[model samples]
Target: MNGQPGTTRAAVVTGADSGIGRATAVRLAQEGLDVGITWHQDREGAEATAAEVRDAGRRAAVQRMDLTVLPEAADAVDRLAEELGRVDVLVNNAGVGTAVPFLELELDDVREVIDVDLVGPLVCGQRAAQRMIRQGDGGRIVNVTSVHEHQPRVGAAPYCAAKGGLGLLTQVMALELAEYGITVNAVAPGEIATPMTGQEDVDVLTVRRPGVPLGRPGDAREVAAVIAFLSGPGASYVTGASWSVDGGMLRMGPHAGSHLESDSWRRP
Candidate 1:
């Protein structure tokens, strides 16, 4: 919002220590916005992301955020906003998932996933939107969802539920925030080469994924590019929409269902 006529702007990207979060922070920096980087357990990775933002000739601030900590943990957004002077964009990129079967899932684990993936973003978005409203300038909020937001996986019941809820939450936020000149959207990513997928530093092109239309795993930067666009002026008219950055994975649902020769896809 501060990037109006003559003011400077800043963006806060949660879980920016690595993967898509890190890439988004750097990309937003390249687009002429100072970046606030957050990490949970990877302080070094957060610092590295901040350095990348700085190298892009933009200011960078680092903060440690534990989404599991609830309302208190979301305070990192305010702290980063204060450090950066103004927050014009917020990327809710931090998330967690589980592989436990639904029937075997412990209540505690399910709660943890929901807390990190859904509640955390809800609170963070509130904090950021409040600041943007007070600033009286338009702002952007991009939620980093997953392809599971639209489809479900066998062993990720909580993850799917949280993401599905978030996809709708994005629409509600967009509608409610529109009056305040705030745009809300979600970016759903598929199999990407990231630490979350245990594929950090691996070349996506070399990893074959026949089910995906792209025939390979996606790169974190590829998702970041779409996020950056949604966070910028070019996407001013876009709101409440969920963009899929899955290399066409979501489109293969029926195709995959019919091609599967065994029950392997049924298991986690």
Candidate 2:
């Protein structure tokens, strides 16, 4: 909103200590926006991300946030907005995964996943949208979901449910926020070579993922590029959409099912 004519813009990227969140924060900074980075338990990684944004010659702010606490989560948005002086773009990238089976999962497990993944984003988005509405200018909100948003995975009942909920939430937000010139969309990524994928220090290309058409895990920067596009002026007409950055994994459902000869897929 601020970058249209002569004003500067700022973005808040939650869960930006590392992985896709860190990459997106840096990408937005490179695109001529100040960045606000947030972390839950990785303050060092958040500071490093802030350094990367500052290295790009953009203003950067870092804060620790526990998204499970909805009020504090919303407060995190306000804190970053105040620090950056504006909140033109918001990337709700803070999320957690639970790989427990549905029948075996404890109530706490499912609730924690939902609280952080669904409710936290809902609150944070509301807070950011309110600020954007007050600014009277257009803004962008990109929710980083997962491939599971569109499909189910084994041993990840809570993660899948939370992502599915978020997918629909993105659409509803897009519909409601359109009046305020705020575009809401999602980026659903597949197996990426991040800490979440158990290969934080390894090359994504080296990771073997035959199910993906790309035949390997994706890099965090690849997903960040897609997120950056949605947040930019070029995607003005795009909203209520989930951009899948999964190396065609979703498209390989039939092939994957047929190729699986073991009962391993059924066990989870």
Candidate 3:
């Protein structure tokens, strides 16, 4: 687990322009890790995140990466490693959320979700694994999954499939990469107050859904803390595990009721 002299660890966080990815990048930088950030269509937001990381006294690099083109994925990782010297941790946090029902969902939409959420991670993981093996140093790969990886969502057919596939992919990676001393795991979070969910309109507690026992939506920082652990030394023994950060939302069954009954409560 030795890092380069000036840089202890270099981390690459995809979809880091906002939400969980942004929070995780900042947190990792605070922990003394130089970070490489990627954005799909938010260069401004990505640069803003890079500024925050630099303000924390960690080096930051921002790049634009569209993960759908699978071949380009390895090159992105290679570029990050070259720029930052070495990458000791890779956080696959880039993903898209879709709310269309299965029947209404088109093949293209489903493919897009899978390409970003599942296939993109696979491509990144492969590239990182090769580097870790070459470095002959133990490395970490943490995938930012969702509670839907285990529980099905009513309107998000494609998202659920992608996460579920990613959950299994994590385990497969852990098994295969153990020989190379690489640990792979996942962090499945529930309703986090982030731009991904239109945070300004969400009132987790007052809405009072039956399933979420905590009666509140989680903050991105909360999930980032767990991710930081998995990436650090403490979680060396933890691999192939999907840690659920949801507030008991997945635990409640049939009894959970919809909190979005009133049209007036919706965001304008």
Candidate 4:
């Protein structure tokens, strides 16, 4: 879906302060779209991303967003869209996870994960889609899920639950928004070299994961490339699909089940 004939496109990418969020913001800027960047705790990082966007000859707007705050926080999406004139694409990339075992998890922790990972995106998607509908131009929405969205991971009960829910939510949004020419999809990533994974600034190629078909963790840029494609004109026909950037990790389910040599994985 193209924007007004001669106007530049604009996008709002949540969690754009670092990792995949930062990468996606910059990549979209390179695609000739002005970007609205959001940061939860890293204002400096968000500014850096904005600077990169500016360097790419596109406008950038930065906002601090706390997704756990609910419907109020979703307002940031509209603010960014306003600052950038209009929002042609929205990438819901902000998320939180927990490593606590199921029995040890507290209600607050679970709620926090659910708020940031699931509910928050839903509201933000609504905001962006509403604007797109009013503009009368088709739009794009990309939800960043995880491989856990399809499978399970020990010590990540709430995380998996939230992601799985988000996966299905993506499908529903696609179905409903398609009538307005707004396409919704999800991008599921595997282990990536990012701050969330405790691998910030590390070279992914230097590390090896024998179990992964790619033999290494993914890079944030790698994930951003996929997201950029989905946000571009080329992916106008693709929606309600979950594109896995997991180095074939999901395909190893049966292979890994048969190759386990110990009970270590059973512990979280």
Return the top candidate by TM-score: 4
Candidate 3 C-alpha lDDT tens digits along 97-147? 798877898998889999999999999998888888887787999999999
lDDT string, candidate 1, 90-172, tens digits: 99999999988889999999999999999999999999999999898889999999999999888999999999999999999
- Model 1 residue 112 lDDT? 94
lDDT of each: 0.92, 0.89, 0.86, 0.93
Q: Write the per-residue lDDT of candidate 2 for residues 139-201, one digit (tens) a residue.
A: 999999998999988899899999999999999999999999999999999888889877686
Expressed as tens digits, the lDDT of each residue in 1-268 for candidate 4 is 8898999999999999999999999999999999999999999999999999999999999999999998999999999999999999999999999999899999999999999999999999999999999999999999999999999988999999999999999999999999999999999999999999999999998986776777788999999999999999999899999999998889888556212444454345
Which regions of candidate 1 are displaced past 4 Å? 1-4, 257-268
- Candidate 1 vs candidate 2: which has greater TM-score? 1
Worst 10 residues of 3 by lDDT: 257-266
Clashing pairs in 2: none
> Whose lDDT is greatest here?
4
At residue 18, candidate 2 shows an lDDT of 93
Off by over 4 Å in 2: 2-5, 257-268
Task: Check candidate 3 and list the clashing pairs.
Answer: none
Q: What's the TM for model 2?
A: 0.94
TM-score of decoy 4: 0.95
